[model samples]
Target: MSTVMVRPLLHLIPTVLIIAALGLSGCSTSKPLPRQTAPPAAVQTDPPAKSHPRTPAPKITGKPKTTISAAKQSVLVSERNRASCYRLQPGKTSTRMIKKHIPAKKAATAAHLAKKDATATTAKPMTTVTRMVTTTSRCQPQSLIYARCRTGIDTCKLGDTSPVQWFACAKNNSATTFEPVAGSVLVLDRNARRGMPTGHPVYVEEVLPSTDNIWQLRISHTNYDRKCHLDQDATVLFNSTEMTASFMTGPWAPWAKDLKALGFIVR
Candidate 1:
C-alpha cells in the first residue's frame, strides 16, 4: 500500500532470488580436497647380544701299567736260615756252592785190619730176641749209633735189622696198638717207603692239639737223615673215637710225597 514499502520489497526479492540460484550452481560443480599426511613416532631398540656354542665334558684316562725290578724280586726271597724254600725239604743244608778242594779218606793200616778181624771173630754171640715185659722203653735207637738190635732199650730184637722186621718183632712182644702216645712207636709199611723195600718206625716224642680234631706230633727217628734226629714236624689224623690213628705224615721228609704211617704201638 505505500510506494516506499512496495519498491524495497521488489528490489529485495530479486536480489535473494539471484543469490540462491548462484549458491545452487556452485554446490553442483564443487570437488573434494586431498587427505593430510602425518610424521612417525619414536620406538625403543636394543643392541644384539653375544652368542656362544655349548662345550663337551673332558674324558677320563686309565692308570699306567707298572713292572717289578730284578733287585726288588730278589729282596722277596727268604734268607739262609729259612732253608726249606731253597732245598724244598727240611733238615738239609744248602748245596749251591762247589768245593775248591776235597779231603781224601785215610788208608787203613795192615795191623788195624788184622786186629779188627780177630775182634769180630771173638765177639760175643748176639741175642736174637729180647723179652718185652714192659710196654715202653726210654731208649732212642739212633743215639746208640749202631745198626744192631738194642735189646729191651729199643722196640727191636737182635735179628731185626730192618724197620719192618723190628715192627713185626714189637707186635710179637704184645706191643700192637691202634693209637699213639708220647712214647709210642709209629710203624709204616713198605708201601710208605719211597722206593725202599723195608718199612720204617718213628718214635713219637710229643702230641699236640691241632685244628678240627686233628693232632700234631714231634717225632724222633733214625735213617731218615741216615742218622738220628730228635724231632720233626708231623700231622696225625684220628678216627671218630680218637683211640685209633687213621693217617700220619712227616711233611718235612724228602719222601713225604709218598710215605705215610700205618699204625702206632702205644705204651
Candidate 2:
C-alpha cells in the first residue's frame, strides 16, 4: 500500500530496454510458430467396417389347373347359343365321310296317310345269322420248297449245321420240288417245326429260268439271324428248293459274297 516512485535515471534505463526488445522483434509472422495442433485420436476406424450385400427374393405367380376324368366318363359343355345344334355320330366304317339322319317336316294329312299305309303292311319275321368258318391259303405239300433250305453246308466252304438240310448227297433225303414256278414261293429249308422265322422273313426273290432250279431262288430278305447281304442270298443254282434258314444272325452267313462268286444269286 506504500507508494514508491523510481528515480528518473532508473525509469529511463528500463524504458530503453523495452524499446530495444520490441525493435528486435521481426516484422514477419515468424512462420506462425509451427502451429502445435494435435492429430485426431487413433479412431479405430476398421477400414469403414465392410458392408455385405443382400440377396434378392424370387417372385411368385399363379395360374389355373385342369384335370381329366376316368376312361368311361367324358367332359362336356352345353351351350344354347346356336339356333340348331347337331349331334355327332359314327357311320359306316368303309366310308371316308360321316352320314347323318335328319328329321323331315311333312303335312299332318300326309303324315297320317303314310302312317295308315305303313300299318296296313304286314311285317316279316327276322332271321338269325350263322357264322361260317374261314380257311387260310395252304402252300405246303403242293411243293417241296421247304426241303431246299441250305444245310449250312456251302459247296464253296460255307459253314454247315451238324446235320444238313436236304442235299443231293443225302442217301434217301435228296432235295426235290413238286412246285416249280416263277410266281410260287419256295422256302430255303424243309424243317417244319423250325419253319417259323424268329423275326426275319425271307420272301421269294424270283423264279429262275431253269425248271429244275425251283429251289434256286433269291430270297427277298435274309434270315434275321443271317448276316447282312446274306439276307439277299439267291439260289443261283438249285438242286433243291426247300432251303431253310434259322433266326437271322451273320458271315454272308460271312461268305455271302463268296456265294455270289460261286453263282448263288441273291434272293
Candidate 3:
C-alpha cells in the first residue's frame, strides 16, 4: 500500500516540478517585462520638430544718405550768410540790431512826410466864384442920374434943374451937411482929371466906421466906369477936414484923387 501511494505522489511531483521550471524560464527570458521600473519613469520627452527651407532677404534701393558732416556744414553756411546782414551786438539778434541802427530823427521825418502827403491828398473846401457882366449896360438914360433915381428924388424937389446943380441948390431947398448919411446925395464939383466935365452925384449907401480923420463910405453911382453904366457898392474914402472924396477901389482906382466934395444933400 505504501509503495503504490509513493509512486503516484512521485508522478505528481514531476509534473509540479516541470510546471515550476517553465515559469522560471519564462520570467528570466522575458527581458524582465522591459524593466517596468515605473515604465522607466514614463520618459516624458516630446517628438522632434520638422525643419523648413530658408528664404533669401530682399535688397533695399534709394538715393544715398547725406553725411552728417556735410549736413552740418550746410547749416553753418546758412547761419553765416544770415548773420552777415546785421552788425549784431552781444545778446542781440538780427532784428534787434536793425532796429537799433535806425535813426530816430529819420524815422520821425519819414512819419511827418507821410502825414503831410496824406494831408495834401485830402480834399479841400470848394470855393464859388462869381463873374460880373461888365460889357452890358442896363441903366436907362434917366437912370444915369444915380442919386436922383436911387433916392426917388427929382431935381425939382431939390430946387434944381439937373443933378450937377443940385449940390448948390440943396442949400436953399434941402439941408446941406459935410457929414455923410445913408440915402443922401454926395456931390462933387466939376473935375477934368477925374473925367467929370459937368459934376458927379453919388448915392450914399452906407457910412462905415471912421478911423482917425478918415471915414469909409460905400457909394453907388452911374456913368463912373462907362456912359450909362451903374456901379454899385463902390468903396470911397472921405477926409473930414479936407472935405474931399476919393475912390478906394474900382475902375476909377487908378485915377484916384481927392476930389472937392461940395456937400451931402439930404432931403
Per candidate, the number of residue pairs that clash is: 0, 39, 0
| Cα shift from native, residue 244, model 1 (Å) | 11
Q: Estimate each model's TM-score.
A: 0.34, 0.20, 0.44
Misplaced by over 4 Å in model 1 are 1-152, 209-213, 226-260
What is the C-alpha local distance difference test score of each model?
0.47, 0.32, 0.63
RMSD of each: 29.5, 29.6, 49.3
Which candidate has the highest TM-score of all? Answer: 3
Root-mean-square deviation of candidate 1? 29.5
Between prediction 1 and prediction 2, the one with superior TM-score is: 1
lDDT of 1: 0.47
> In model 1, what lDDT does residue 169 have?
69
Cα lDDT tens digits, model 1, 186-209, are 766675235346766665556676
Task: Kindly list the per-residue Cα lDDT of model 3 for residues 58-120, writing each as its tens digit.
Answer: 212221244655544543443344223222122222221111222233233455556745665
Return the candidate ranking by TM-score, descending: 3, 1, 2
lDDT of 1 at 127: 32
- Stretch of 10 with least lDDT, candidate 3: 50-59
Q: lDDT, candidate 1, residue 113?
A: 63
